[model samples]
Target: MNPERTSAGPILITGASGQLGAALVKGAQAAGLAHRAVQRPAFDFDNPASIAQICAETSPSLIINAAAWTAVDAAETNQDAAWRANRDGPATLAAYAAEQHIPLIHISTDYVFDGSKGAPYIESDQVAPLGVYGASKEAGERAVLSTGAASMVLRTAWVFSAGRANFARTMIEAGRKRPELRVVADQRGTPTAAPDLAAAILRIVALIQRTGWQPHYGGIFHATNQGATTWHGFATEIFAQAARHGETAPTIVPITTQDWPTPVRRPADSRLDGQKLAAVFGITLPDWRDATRRVIADMLTQPASAP
Candidate 1:
């Protein structure tokens, strides 16, 4: 396919079915940026030829890669599957973007850190991945960066969105089924809204275009809400908001990560410092609580059944 012929137009987004991808589609249209959202049964990350073909065919001036293997604990046993999507998939797209000389916007995760440190992780912080999913994500981060293409690697944590199944959705469902829910209280991070994150990506892209990438806004940035809260706190908020939405709220029982043991070792603190994002963008993200409330409101009021 002649890619150069089509490179003169709108942005192209991958993982359209995912929450973040859906948000980007809406955000791009709302922001008045010409764009396309590609997802399965049309776009499949497991197939490299498909990825290459679409990249060349679409020839998007900007490519936002939101596709990823997000099953954290499942990665412990499904390592290859995770890397195929998380590492090789990104590597393929980044290589194409580099060759085409177009900017690639990549989504990353906060699990790259081991979480032993009791402070928020900065863009420059050392990474010590504690699990298979984390390792795969770290590798994918390097893969995209190594391409030397203009790219933005955004690492966010505790994402909950209205369009997809997430912590908030799970809590709301369990709250309806069970009398009480036990959530981990030790782990902490900003409960990023997928739509908010989508907005951040677009803003970065706009900034890159306006600023001419001089500041190399191409590297890693921690984009999330302004504050940190534990899983227990997050669940409590979800339940409370559900009640406010005229729905039944479940009692949330707080528990440590050990008490709610899982196959993977979760970071005690998934907090990502947004200082650089704020400084560079000259803006501060709203608190997670506010974002969460918006998401809950959107979910409860939507016509679709709540997950």
Candidate 2:
């Protein structure tokens, strides 16, 4: 593999408006790294010209692709849009990065696995996505890897943050109106804070730039806050954390996946094992509960209508 030529140009970050993307931009600035954040209209995945245009304009030395069509339920009826955004758009970015001879770090999801392993999934675990959303993301992973570019596909699970629509924000908003909340206890995965994930990504990038790309740096790796919990457990922690911020705690009812039905079937246990990331790059995210508290604090500090 050819080592990417380091340049003084800005690091290009896509999906700058989303939770993770926004956090990535913040992390980059705090690290004093020059970067350019791009989102829809100007950097749309559906519009191939927009993708090419941004690449030419920025002439980025490195690229972080955080853009995705993350509407899981909506993707059921909107397969075409999901594929275009999650699969096609990332493919375009991967190809561009390959041509430019730059390393690309693409954020992915644990949903790429079917969650039937009854144990934490490693990077090489078999993938059997149950919905179009996961399938598209899995396809995107393949696309990025197929480009033969120096790329890192980092898969995280149950992402949440202070910005945008996320589980923490949803639960907090619901607690304000509802007396009790029913969360699925059957499904299990790690609750990844966007800021924590963003920090990890930036660290990985810095390591690559510092030592140049190594053979082990390319390919898939699991990244999320340490530990795992069911959705019900996650909700309980959210309410608990919100209580510390003077918010009222709601009655959290633990229910099975069968209790609530959606168009898509999420994995029953999609917890990702993050050993490879730590072993390869000496990077590990903060504890899941600590990360959860940080995000809950951020949410409580925000205006009521922030989400």
- What TM-score, computed on C-alpha atoms, does each candidate reach? 0.95, 0.97
Q: What do the candidate models score in CA lDDT, each in turn?
A: 0.85, 0.92
Give per-residue CA lDDT, model 1, range 72-94, as digits (tens).
99998998889998999998888
Give residue 232's error in model 1 in angstroms: 0.3
- Model 2: lDDT equals 0.92
Q: After superposition, how far is residue 173 of candidate 1 from its true place, in Å?
A: 0.6
Per residue, candidate 2 scores C-alpha lDDT tens digits across 9-102 of: 8999999999999999999999999999999988898899999999999999999999999999999999999999999999999998889789
Choose the strongest candidate by lDDT.
Answer: 2
